[model samples]
Target: MRLATVADMPRIGTLMRVSGAELFPRFYTERQAASAAIYLTEPDITLIKDGTYFVYEAGGEIVACGGWSKRNKLYTGSGSQQDDGRLLDPATEPARVRAMFVRADWTRRGLAKAILDACVKAAREEGFRSLSLMATLPGVPLYHAFGFQETRQTMVPLPDGVQLEGVEMTYELSQ
Candidate 1:
């Protein structure tokens, strides 16, 4: 795994779409999945630019990507530019676990766990006391297994007037 660069956006985007296509249907209707898929943003450039995003490559192919952020935005990068890029106050706010995606063929291989471990370590090193993320249905099990407690269930509005179900989860970092 390594820090993602601007040039990696295309491949990252492909991975997200492919993963979503393969996994979303397990929990969502075909129509819902189609609408929700629109929200799977490529590389949130801000994360990459901040050196917080990472990509796991195998045999010269990027198989997984994820990252943590000190930024205030919970999520971004689906062709939206409304973020102000404010930094979080680690003393009070939990660091955000941003975009996480794995290729269809790479699921259940502990790739997400490896990425989450890195994100937790990095956030703790940055002085964060906790971590939070808006997890999709397919991701809830993984997050829960890693000690993230569900705080709420939310419906994230998509562009086509569709709302995708998501869970807000948090984890306290070990000091």
Candidate 2:
């Protein structure tokens, strides 16, 4: 895994598109999956800009991508959501686990785990006591297995008027 550069956006976009389209349908309706594929996969360049985003590559292709954010963006979607782009107070606010995606054929391969491990380590180093994420249905099991407890059910409002179901989960870094 490596820090993702702006040049990696094209490949990252492809991985997210294929991953969301292929995996979301297993837990969501086709239309909902389609909408998620379009909106949820949109890369938040802030991650790359902040030097937090990481990508896993195999044979020169990016197979997975994810990162943590010190900023206030919880997840990606329409701008009307809670993403304010303000920096978080590590003592008070939980760092965000943002935009995790694995390629369609890359499931169960420990890629997300490695990325999450990196995120946890980085956030802890930054004095963050907890981590939070808005996890899509396909990601709940993974986060659950990784020790993220479900806090609530969230609705991700997309630009196309589709609201995708998501889970708000938090992990205590001290644990």
Candidate 3:
């Protein structure tokens, strides 16, 4: 895996859509999946620009993407007006693990774990004591296995009047 660039946005967006469509049905209702599909926005340029985003390529195809951030925005790329790009106080706030997705054909192969491990290591090196993420229903198991504790569950309202259930999870980095 390597850092993603703006040029990789199209492939990353495609991977997210394909992965979401295949995986969300395992936990979400059909209507919810369809409506919430709008939530699968393109890669956030800020992540790429910040050099925090990464893509895993195999057989010359981008198959997985994810990242961590020191920014206050917990999530973005859904075309929402919510992200403010404020810097996180790493002294107090946990680093944000954002936008994790794997290709439909690439699930359960340790790609997510690899990405998370990279993010955790990077965050720790950056002096963060903890990491946090808003995980979709399909991602809970992976995060849970990676030592993340769910702090809360909430619904994210999509633009199409549908809501996606998500969990807020955190992990404390071992010193």
Alpha-carbon lDDT of model 2? 0.92
Off by over 4 Å in 3: 77-83
- Computed on alpha carbons, the lDDT of every model, listed in order, comes to 0.85, 0.92, 0.86
What CA RMSD would candidate 2 show? Answer: 1.3
lDDT of 1 by residue, 3-89 (tens): 899999999988888888888889898987887666765568889998889899999888999999998878642234455488989
Rank by lDDT (best first): 2, 3, 1
- Of models 1 and 3, which has the larger lDDT? 3
- For residue 142, model 1's alpha carbon misses the true position, in angstroms, by 0.6
| Candidate 2 per-residue lDDT over residues 75-157, each given as its tens digit | 88846445468999999999999999999788899999999999999999999999999999999999999999999997878
After superposing candidate 1, which stretches have Cα over 4 Å from the reference?
77-84
**What TM-score does candidate 1 reach?**
0.93
Where is model 3 poorest over a 10-residue stretch in terms of lDDT? 75-84
Residue 66 of model 2: what lDDT? 99
Tens digits of lDDT, candidate 3, 72-143: 778753344544588887789899999999987898999989999999888998889999988889889999
**Clash number for model 2?**
0
